[model samples]
Target: MKKPKLELDEPQPRKIIRADKAPTEGYSLVVDGHFKSHHDTVEAAEEAGMALKNRYQMLQIQVYDAVTKTRSMIEWPAPV
Candidate 1:
């Protein structure tokens, strides 16, 4: 028996917004998805982080900025 092949297509647009700082660079908000990367730029990374949080209610997320060579894990629901 031969294994079946799987095909992947471009992601559908759930929600897209023009980044204030990076106007030309837009962000896509996906549903029931997880994203992982080690790219630079905290702001950009955080934008994605917050998006995931807002959409999926993720309590925490990890971020790594190659440019600054920094890594940190951000958590939500901080003590008042």
Candidate 2:
């Protein structure tokens, strides 16, 4: 039997900081699953995430390190 092909749905709006190698940079900042920019360090990427929060009012942010394969999340200004 043959199987059919599958396609994924559109991505949702979100912020992410993660390590990357394809760009030849140290790390990258992504928004809504789209590459936003690259940074020299993860810390710089985190700063970009904060900037996204302040500028775009994003409620949540996710950080991932490809080197360590670890992930974390940041909540922008705890909901009141």
Per lDDT, the best of the predicted structures is: 2
lDDT (tens digit, per residue) of candidate 1 on 18-75: 2332222223222232334322456776667666566666455655443443445554
Return the lDDT, model 2, position 42: 88
Best by TM-score: 2
Instruction: Give the lDDT of residue 27 in candidate 2.
Output: 58
lDDT of 2 at 22: 29
Residue 13, candidate 2: how far off, in angstroms? 33
As a whole number from 0 to 100, the lDDT of residue 71 in candidate 1 is: 44
Model 1 clash tally, residue pairs: 0
Cα lDDT tens digits, model 2, 1-80, are 88987878978978454334324336555555545566678888888787787877754565556566554554576345
Instruction: List TM-score per model, in order.
Output: 0.37, 0.49
- Show the colliding residue pairs in model 1: none
Candidate 1 whole-model C-alpha lDDT, 0 to 1: 0.47
